[model samples]
Target: MRRFILIFLIVILCTFPAFAQENYCKDKEPWKEWDKLVQKYPHNMDIQMLHAVRIGFCKKIEDSTITFEVASDAFNHLHETVYKKDMAVKVREVLDEARDSV
Candidate 1:
């Protein structure tokens, strides 16, 4: 019985990371759709902001240490290209939240 329990615990521990990665991959699936939308509407600030946020989210899930730089770059691009100051502020807020999640 002790041996069986030990074997079961080992299996559970080994499988946990796989399950987490599967969910991570599933969560990341939306980025592909977002990419398509960005391609379709390159000038759309909303879509671009969402894409940047998704990029941050995926990076955070994969590795928190590397998310800040990439997310910052995306936010900077949005701020530079997006014409409306108010919209740029909102995009910055979204990027902040994404970075905070990491």
Candidate 2:
């Protein structure tokens, strides 16, 4: 029983950050634009992953209010993920157009 309680507490602690991150940049300007892009290009894995990357970036910074400039910086500086060159270029172009509307 004691071990079960401890495990439950540990699980809750581990999940707290996920919940915190979920709300970090949701429903904001760039993300709203991102959502539309995601819907428009549902088959584009690059766009989907880029959305995840931006959300992860926002979570890493613990910032809820993300602007286009901040997202652009994150998108440009990502070093860990390798994407298909042309698709990545297209995604960035679409992102830039979205920024204009925001």
Task: Name model 2 segments beyond 4 Å from true.
Answer: 1-27, 63-74, 79-84, 87-102
**lDDT agreement of model 1 with the native:** 0.53
Candidates in order, TM-scores: namely 0.36, 0.42
Per-residue accuracy of model 1 over 1-102 as CA lDDT, tens digit each: 323333433453344345443433244544565566678668866556756765665667477655444544544455434335544565888899999999
Clashing pairs in 1: none
lDDT, residue 102, model 1: 100
User: In candidate 2, which residue pairs clash?
Assistant: none
Compared to the true structure, candidate 1 yields what TM-score? 0.36
Give the per-residue lDDT digits (tens) of candidate 2, residues 4-60.
Answer: 333433453345345444444544765676678678667766566767886776776
lDDT of each: 0.53, 0.56
Error of 1 at 24 (Å): 5.5
